[model samples]
Target chain A: MQPFLPVYAPLSDQQIKHIEDMADQVLAEVGVILQDDPISHEAMAAVGARIESDKVFTKGDDLRALIAQAPRQFTWYGQSPECDVVIGEKPLYAPTYGPPVVETHDENRHQATMADYEALVLLCDRSELLGTTGSLLTIPHDVPEEARPIAMARAHLEHSKKPMCGSIISEQALRDVAHEVGTDPSKCHLMHMINTTPPLVIQPNPLRCLRAAVELGQGNMVASYMMMGATAPVSIMGALAQGLAEIMVGLALTQIYRPGAPVVGGLFATPFEMQQMGPMFGSPQSQLVQIAGAQLVRRLGVPCRGDGMLSSSKLNDAQAGYEGAITLAASQLCQADFILHSIGWSEFGRSYNFDKCLADEALILSSI
Target chain B: MQPFLPVYAPLSDQQIKHIEDMADQVLAEVGVILQDDPISHEAMAAVGARIESDKVFTKGDDLRALIAQAPRQFTWYGQSPECDVVIGEKPLYAPTYGPPVVETHDENRHQATMADYEALVLLCDRSELLGTTGSLLTIPHDVPEEARPIAMARAHLEHSKKPMCGSIISEQALRDVAHEVGTDPSKCHLMHMINTTPPLVIQPNPLRCLRAAVELGQGNMVASYMMMGATAPVSIMGALAQGLAEIMVGLALTQIYRPGAPVVGGLFATPFEMQQMGPMFGSPQSQLVQIAGAQLVRRLGVPCRGDGMLSSSKLNDAQAGYEGAITLAASQLCQADFILHSIGWSEFGRSYNFDKCLADEALILSSI
Candidate 1:
């Protein structure tokens, strides 16, 4: 089935403009803090941005011009030529990322083992619905944390041909993956997750990953993972403006470092439930953020990332289905390009349940 | 909380007009048949509609003019003034209707007894979320099938003061409920489900109920329940147009019988799964029909009916969640009024699962 060409854009032009203006204000005034990343600071300085301590204050117009160097769309190569995927065209689905637990049945959660990870990779490989083989379906506790990224990359190369994301644990992890895959620099062969610390900060590790991945001629997805009411404001538009400012800093860094770098802007915002002091997923408020974020990112002239079936529900029950459907429907309606956590997400990114995955896939197939 | 005022319209004006044109063609040419109802046949003939046996062939414009007599909105009074509900202003939620089985836990289904029916009424009465008490959450096997409607109505009135839908089994059942409730003609005190037989026909029972309900100054919801690909064409727009034509016949009948009758137009279209020979609910295709139907009914100048949390899953699982959410979200997005089956529906309306009801209500509460 063809990707959705939405006739209804939820955000009005004026509303979109207000968000852009707010983001620009944050960029020029609040600025973005980059920790322990000299290359990024130097690049921003070269672009005539003012630097105070670790924060780089820049005109939004200059950042926009630099970000224009990035390609609007790019081809991501798989292990084989036939598996290549074109980003910024259709929603390229990938399975759950960064879950630490696993379950096959209700309330039967356990620490995710290497066996679980391999099983997920095998399951994802066999499904025609998923366009890319995602990293970190779960953190296999058996594997040492540092070596896990390399282990994952090797497994991707050894098992599946679909495009895979590199590890963001450290710059070396990304480099090792590139070497293991024998990545072709002339063409983008890998993608990596680079998250910005919320409320107006970019941590050192993500900064290094962004610069390193772009330099290696690979794609980067700059994700702003904010828990609203804690790291960001409780107001929907307020949190969105903060998220946009942070992502633009990362996107602009890619272009300033290397003209025409492949990058994706992602806004993964969920409300902070005060009662639990944790982030809530698959709420209607979050769905609105996804839809508006898609519209804003599209105007930013790059591919956007959205999550599928993100749920707070523990079981593969009615709660999970409704939450996941609304979230996925938001992405589908807005025509999001890169969809992460497309299925099998449970408990606010806590577990990867196999049964939930099958249920999600069924929903996807029926929709198509 | 305010109901959804959608800024995004899934259908273009041209598309909507195309459906309208198709419906008009069906009304003028193929027409609609009324079975064993001479009053309806005589009423159509009085309006200058050509009566060929039981079928009424009237120009679409004539039907539209007749439908104009019904109010765009109406107030449905509860037993007390404080519990009264205004239907066309917001999505007034009513629980699952017309299921013959009950399940409190997974795989523990049993025939619904009168005690189960009373328990549902008590559960609904205590809830602040449900706007009205709905009839036939499950059929009580202890009651005679012919007397079931009156029993259900008495249970609703004795337990809750909320507005309710009257029985649809027979005309006598409706009159009996009205007499028991001591319905006032000055106010719209009761509503009845008046379903149009699919593929351009209206059964005798529904016609009699519609006439009786309107004459007593009560409300009638004209629902077209079509199993697409079997009863109507398989295409989304085709099924939608056919549904629209059928509903128009029922709506026009209400107005012609009594000007300013309280009425709702409902389009309930689920695909007939060819393999199973059963209707499938909660598919994205059905959601589209719901959304488009909402927009069309708004143009026809009456409140629209939409089902909430309708699902085909036997368990309250992830399939139920996603399906329920997507279906409910469609109604929410379109700001549909008079929502029936707002929670606790399962297996194509076969059972009213109590757990699913709570799960579905949580979703509704969180959204609000």
Candidate 2:
């Protein structure tokens, strides 16, 4: 089937150009902080990037050239050939990831266990709408920190045949998941999500994971998870510029590490709520950011990644439905390539509800 | 603001042309039953319509000529100047109309009284999103049948500064409401909804109301309320053809009654659920119909009318939110000019929930 075209563009071409120029300026002048990662600093210095202590600066032309080397589209292979997905051709859906709690009708709230993780993987496998099983639909609290990645990967391998993500917490965790799944990273069976800290900073662990993934030739979804009005600029264009700068740095690094590496660029941010003293999700501002981000990614000739069916509501009530529907619809209309958190997300990604997950799957199919 | 362009088009020009041609054939060959109304029968005969008892037939060219006489767009004056709205330029929202029951947080459901009607009118008046204080948001059972129109009109006139609708049960009711509101028919303040009984029949009361509205130079929303697979054809295109034929007949009658009258066209229908033995609302099929209907209305060079925030769920729960959001988004994207049942519809329009009404209003404002 042909890919769905964007029905709405939140930013005009002139506005997109202005934001792109600003992003380039931020990359060249302000630079990005490579926090506690001397390896990244050395790598940047070797690639003609200027290194001044922790800050690494690169010109817009250099970043663009590196970005141009990355593949515009790539296929992520699943265990079954029928489950493989072409990343840049259409909007692919994945389940909500990294939630720490699970909510069911019997239990109001409980720490997610390995059993819950396996069940969720099974659900994703059975769902016609979900394209990927997703990594960490909820954190398995019963599993020890050292062995969690292996256990999660085993659950995914055993219960689902869909393409799934490898752990990004550490280099070892990423390797463990790939080895357990019998995935050849050179062919890129598993993808990894590397999130940058706000205000143009890449932490040591995430940077390490990025290097490991690139060296192994695994796909990467590089993103900046910033909170506007707090860690990033409050304005939409400003925040977009900052986000673009961060993601571009990460993406450019992937190309430098291994040219023609498969990577999806992401821009995910939320406006900070002063009263709650936290970030809000499924908001109109965030939705606009997602739409504008898609436009930017399209301009860069890379696949765009963002969340779908995201909500801050605690229960699967009207608020959850409205918020989820709005965000999901926005993602579809914006022509996002890969939609994360496509189902079972609640309470700012803290809790995953089973009934809501089922309902959201139906919603996704209806939309298609 | 400029009108919203369609985000989705369910029918292509070729398909629409085919449907229109089929509709013309239906009108000229099959004819329509003008039920139990001698006045309408005589009027149809006078206008070169072939009448045999109750069946009134006319060729496509005559109907087209009559339809061409009606204005493309007109202003609907509200009590306050700021509240006055241009009918065809953009989507105009109106509250839910003609529900006999009301639901609240404390009560499951109860018979609606005059108090409920007045409160709803007041709510619509205060709502920033609602464009019109819709007629009979809930049936005022306390009001006697003969005085219902006067009571409903008074509630709207006294509580709201927005545009509203008049009664459509009888010609007397239409004139009574107009006289009570002191509206000049030439510049219609109150619009009337005239529903045609499918397949291809206009009952006596609605025909009488239509004639009265047209003769007085008032605006009329002529529609075919069809139940697909039951009262109309099962196929979407076939149902659309039948609906178009019915509505065009009413539109022609309005033009024949008084040329250059303000009018809006509507195509409202739902697919029948065989097991449930009822029509389902807020379904994906209905949303598609609405989008295709908007394209049809646009081609006719007239404003389109439909519903918003419609749901089949009994409770204002996740189902309600999802269904309502899908339909509402579809209506907005389709560029419906007059969105009736804009808020607080539930159980397929059998009951109106107060909480849902408020939430739906907020949803509407957020979209803008």
Candidate 3:
């Protein structure tokens, strides 16, 4: 029931040099592809990157050469030997737990109540997962906005001793959860999915939240979610490269604003539709992009995050299981440092089925 | 890429009635114990179970009722769709790709091979994976006389697929690799794991090999793999049922007798040393049992096989990643039709390493 952290190999001398060299190249020659985000444009300009409108191109050789020198392994600390989980150059790791949101048989996706959150926390507390506990579902949608964060924090405080991660939509919510859970900002591992501002841009609010987590010395997860066929390029490889470029820009800002912030390079890239709103379910391109992109990020010596068991279907049936298993396993096998949507997660992170949760737990036990 | 066959809901109302009746009884009386394997014996037996020893208990209700009731979701026909993938209430169908085998890396420990017979098939062809192809290392030395069967069938066949599963020596291997590939069999969809027999259980005969696979037909894949730790129980349940019981009783016999059969049970239970060896790698428990057990058998309904990544260390690192991820994910998620070691593969399937694989793949995909 305790957290399961894996120990990663220390970066080899070559790998360390690779990270430093890649950083320098990324900073100097390998500029990012920025769109209308004023902050991104300004940041690239300040860094002396060649900027032409929204597209920033750097010296190809410098970027590629530096990237080649990046590290392939890194270490992660845990409360105990048992808590340690390694990233880069190892197998996958399972996330602690996600709360069940939708009751299995429900028609309408209801809000996750305090009781639901509590039960999810209990399940997570009793699971052998990695660093952060997840916001299993849409928590208590009916509760007053002011009381939500506090109610959510109470569950973490009472049920678990593991290093938990979460999202607070507002600055006030962040502080409220912090106080209720008795967490030292320096020790909090904050995680959130930061999607690219579609149609070319990075929004300021997400950037602000990321910066706050960084300043607090909390773990920051910057996810570059790209729908393969929609707002982004149709090519998977292209999408992956673009996503990496965006996140790298974000990561650079983190270091510049708050150096040595515990930032994890995150990518939630998956296939999308130009028409119907549906998940492609185990898009190999998505899986490949995630894996390859994670490798690219780790080349910079930072941990990376990936999605697992994520599907658009809203049920705990075969499609959910198939999609969940493939995506989750890919993330885990690739040795991702941080994993979101690890357990009891279904309907594309919408609702949670108890049976699915049990099934996910059984998988976690069998896998991690 | 070929379309995956799916398991469909039962057609006959009579079958539906039977399944519903079974579900009711199971919910009320045959409550499943999601605990370590040993404790579930009495509960399983209580359902009018026939105990063929601790390792081989078959509750008549568990097998007969469930087998008929089990739907084939995403199952394969003679190169076509065998059934429809039931999204929620129906059983999931997955394919098996590779055979279990170990590869040696610089002579430190025997690691499972990624380019084994079964593994390559999954990757090379349109299989869903590129699994751990074969199952023994230095077999030329370990089983000089027994090498022909593996070489002739499994290795030769599995090399022709796209995605596939891997092999597991310990429970950890299952967990680690599952996390890496983005899914674990036990948790995600229809997957399998093969628990082998103790020191030198198989006699290396052809009939036995055929029988093992044939008997494992749409039944349980809980293979019997005796280990040294807590898996070493006081009775047959302690010894056999702990891990190896599923294969010996549930899978092998089913597969050996019924080719292309579908079964849903398996295990990789092994034992600690009672006589000479001190938990050696690729011990008879790791090799002979799985090879000669139920994995190779052909089931009429569907294939039953268990898989996991095999690693020597307890944490995530290059050794863990290459040893676990490439081997296991290659088979289970990437290819195998029916698989087991889809996740939690590390330290030879003992402990779970959460998110390590997520980060590691960041490095694995530089080539892509």
Candidate 4:
């Protein structure tokens, strides 16, 4: 069956051009801070970037040229050859990542266990909607912190033949995942998520992980999760520009590490609620940003990544469903290429619910 | 704020034209059955239609001309001037209609009472999302059948000031509602639902109600509830064509009864689940039909009506949220002029839940 085409575009050409110009200006003038990574600082300096304290400034044209080196589409292979997936043409669903707690149908919240993690990996394997067994379906508190990534990788290999995301906590964790999976990044079996800290900063650990992944020829989903009105500007355009600038720098570094590496660009920004001092999801502003962010990524000729089926609701109630549906629909209509956190999310990603995962899987498949 | 615009259209102009031609052919050749309604048969015959037994065969152009006489937009008045609603520009939301049972938050379901009916009206009045106190929020089984319309009208007048749908069970009921509301049809104070029984048939009661409403200068929402694969063809285009032909005949009859009477065109079709022997709501095919139906209605320059937040779930669970969100988003993106069943629907509209209604109201308002 043919994949669905996106017929809706929230931004006009003039608006898109304006955003692109603003993003470029931010990259050239107010460069991003590369904190606690002297290796990257020296490498960027060698490539004509100006280093001032932790900030690394580069010309917009130079970054664009580097971005141009990355392939627009790439094959992400699984352990089973039949499970190989394409990145650019159609949207692909991946299970939710990075939640530490589990909420069940009885409304009980408890720390997740390795058993829960394995069960989720098996669920993703069985799902018709989810194409990948995403990393960190939930944090298994029962497992030691250092051993969690290994356990998660082993679960993915045993339960699911689908391609999987690699660990991004540190350089060693990334290598550990690569070694466990036989470390053949040329086959593109492992992809890693590299998130930039908001307000134009890249943390040392994630930056090191990015370098490790690229050096090993693994693909990267380079992203920035900006909390609008807090870490980023309050205006949509301004926040978008800042996010694009930050991600562009990250994408450029990937190209510098490996000139033709596969990378999916992403910008996931939601407004920070002042009263709550936290981020809000599924708001209209966030939805608009998702669409506009896709347009920007498409302009760069690369596949885009976005959150799928997201919600801030604490329960798997009507709010979760409505909010999840809105975000999922937005990602699909906005032409997202890789949708992470596609199922089993609740309480603003604080908890993952088992029943909600099953229900969301049905929703996603029905939509297809 | 400006009402949302449809940035997406499911069908292209060529596809829309093909569907229009198919529908016209069905009207001219296949015709539609006006079962047990001599008034509609005679009125249609007066407009150069050929009546053979119960079927009225009319040329598509004649029906189109009659449909053209109805105004593109009209004011649906409330008791207070401040409550008046414009039907064609901004989208308007109305509560669910025709649920026979009420489900509370505690998961108890019982036959609705007059008190429950009044509470629903008050709820609609208090809701920021619901613009009208839709008719029959629940069936007040406690009230006598003959007096139900009067009771419903009284609830709307005393408990809420929002505009409402008039009774359509019989001509007397329609007139009784008019009298209770002191309705001036010339001002289109009362809007009535005129549903065509599926498989190209118009039931006697609804037909008579349509005639009474048109004669009194009141507005009509002419619609068809086709269950695809049962009452209509399984193909989306085929079902849409059949529904369009059915509604066009009804719209033409309204014009024939009283030329230029207010009428909103509607086509609500869902696929019949053959295995379950029931109709399925919020299917992708149904969503596609809705968007295409909107395009067809826009071609006729009249307002369109559709279900706002429809679901088939038994509870306000994840299924309910996802299904409701899909239909609601489809209706809004399709540029539906007036949305009924905007909240509180469950179990395929067999039951209305109070908590679901409240939650859906919050979802709708937040989206706006």
How would you encode candidate 3's per-residue C-alpha lDDT over B234-281 as one tens digit per residue? 232233223322232343233324423444443344445556444432
Residue-level lDDT tens digits of model 1 in B221-295: 998988999999898788888889988889988899888898999987998999999998888878888888888
Candidate 4 chain B — worst ten consecutive residues by lDDT sum? B1-10
True contacts kept of each: 0.79, 0.33, 0.00, 0.57
Tens digit per residue, CA lDDT, model 1, A280-359: 88888888888889888877788998889888888766667888898898888777889999888887788888887887
Q: Write the per-residue lDDT of candidate 2 for residues A101-168, one digit (tens) a residue.
A: 99976856899999888989999999999889989788899999898999999999998889999998
Candidate 1 Cα RMSD (Å): 2.3
Give DockQ: model 3: 0.03
lDDT per prediction? Answer: 0.85, 0.84, 0.44, 0.85
Off by over 4 Å in 1: A1-8, A104-115, A140-146, B1-8, B105-108
Question: Per TM-score, what order, best first?
Answer: 1, 4, 2, 3
Tens digits of per-residue lDDT for model 4 on B1-368? Answer: 12223345657777788889998899888989999888788888888999999998888889888889888889998878898999997888988989999987787789999988998999999888877887978889999999899999999999878788899878999998988888875788888888898888998988989888887878899988889999999988899899999999998888888888899988888889989999998776677778778878767767998677798788888778888888888787776889989999889999999998988888888777
- Against the true structure, candidate 4 reaches a TM-score of 0.94
lDDT of 4: 0.85
The deviation in Å at residue A53 for candidate 3 is 7.0
Interface RMSD of every predicted model, in angstroms: 2.8, 4.2, 18.3, 3.0
Error of 2 at B248 (Å): 3.1
Output the lDDT of residue A71, model 3.
29
